[model samples]
Target: MKFLHIADLHIGKRVNEFNMIEDQKYILEQLISVIESEKPKGIIIAGDVYDKSQPSGEAVELFDDFLTKLVSLAEFVFIISGNHDSPERLSFGSRILKKSGLYIAGVFDGKMNKITLKDEYGPLHVYLLPFVKPAVVRAYYDEEIESYNDAVNVIISNEKISMDERNILVAHQFVTSGGVSPERSDSENISLGGLDNVDASLFRNFDYVALGHIHRPQKIGRDEIRYAGSPLKYSFSEARHHKSVTVLEIKEKGNVKIDLIPLLPLRDLREIKGPINELIKIGKEDYKGSTDYIHATITDEDEIYDALGKLRQVYPNIMILDFDNKRSRSNISFEELSSEKIESKSPLDLFEEFYEAQNNKKLSEEEIKIIERLLEKAGGIEI
Candidate 1:
């Protein structure tokens, strides 16, 4: 049986304050085209159906239309919820939708959701394990589930998985291989110091493990364990990512083949660095991707008047404006300063110094008065 693996739709997302509704709509259309051509038996959307816990009305409507079209194209459509999604919201009408070959495993109900499908070889068991934390899993099981790895291990171990049949696991978590992490982008919300990582060794029994949460497409530990990254670039850090959908064909138990079908977006996210005048000149003269979402870094030492206005005339969709000049670079670092010097200064003096260090300029008299009033309200050190 052939199936397409996709995840992290992040519907109704906004990148750098620019709404991506049109971009998402265009990409979904392309995805539908791909589905028509591939004619897969099943479509697996691992997790992260929406960007936020409470998505906008337009986002809900867009997903409704997409899901409707998906059920018409494929025999089975499997979906799960990620950390960003509200499980209760996503699980709404799931039982009703299951009648139409749409299986949504949104809430973790103390057991893994398994759906059996028959093919030429035998039974293919597809398990849907939604995003779960240590606390969430611990509530159901008495086993000591301290970390993410322990939680996942306990959950899978409890399942009566038959090694004889071809089984596929769909999950969303921060997975690592032998203490090494997968390539990550700024868009993903990973815990500090690798606190949320679940080792890939736990998934050795499954034929394939389709993963999500990380926005970079990559394999973890083995070829069968993979992450189907987001369809569109959500940040400038992902400017180089070649977004694609994973297509898998399961011939029999322990026999699986994979392919990556590239996905093209409406407006590609990009980064451009140079003087404001040079960037504008290039945009006007030879730059073909003027409408592309851009993060522009101005390198001019002298401040340019109306730099954003000037750049917008050429590259209309510029999302961020940054500076790499001497002023920005010359900002003082507190770490380099002496601790004695810091301790000797008054609280108000320290605030003024810190503010100047950050903005490359001193605070005004009115700003000082505002800080003084705030300090007085708190009954802090005398100014």
Candidate 2:
């Protein structure tokens, strides 16, 4: 059995305040075209179908259209909701869709969904465990779920899966092996520290583990366990990532071959570090791909007049601008800065620091007010 592994579509996502709907549409079309050529038996969408839990109307339409086309290309399709999705909403008509060769696994109601496919060899079980939290699992199982590994192990143990046969597990979590986490991008909204880490050893029984949550495509511990990565470069931090879809060919139990089909984006994300004047003088012939989205780091010792304006004259889609002079580099380390800020900063300042780290810019006054209201509601703190 052959299948296409993809994840983290993040439709309706915005980068540097620019909407990516058109770019997403273009990439999805390319994906569908590839699907038509490869003609895999099925497609496994690990998680993070949309950018937000309550996706916008346009996002809903975009996903709906994609699914409509996908079901026509592949016979069996499996999808699970990620932390960014509302499970109930994603699985609204899951029962009805399953009849049409689409299996949707959203909420975890104390059980994991398993669908068995077959070839000439034997049965191939495909287990779907959507993005899970310790608290959610504890509520259902009523057990001591102290860590992510514990939660997952307990859930799979209840399923009574036979390890003798070939099994493919689809999961979305921060999977780590020997204290080493997978590569992360700025677009992924993960918890700080190691609160969400799940040991990869918990999934040793499975033949191929299709993982999500991390945007950089890589194998964890072994080649069989992999992250397909996002179809596009969502952040400047992922500028070096060669985005692709993982194609798996499972001939028999414990016998699998993997291939990564590269995905080329409509506009690439690029970073250039130099003086503003040098960047402005870059001719079209000198830089063939100047139209790509740019993150420029100006290295001039003194501040140039309207530096961004000058660079924009040459590169229209400049997304990020920063100074990399002596003054900028002579800053304290992140550990020291975070420690001092925690001791001296107010709640708002702390929140702004976190926001700026996730996003590349500080929150606006309106956005800050929204955060204040949410904090007040969650913790009953008067800000």
Top lDDT prediction, candidate number: 1
lDDT of 1 by residue, 95-154 (tens): 999999999999999989999999899999999999999999999999998899999999
Worst-scoring 10-residue span by lDDT in model 1: 326-335
lDDT of 2 by residue, 271-309 (tens): 988877777777344565677889999998875889888
Which stretches in model 2 have alpha-carbon errors above 4 Å? 286-288, 330-383
How close is every model to the real structure, measured as TM-score? 0.88, 0.84
Q: Kindly provide the TM-score of model 2 when superposed on the true structure, using C-alpha atoms.
A: 0.84
Question: In model 1, which regions exceed 4 Å deviation?
Answer: 286-288, 331-336, 339-383
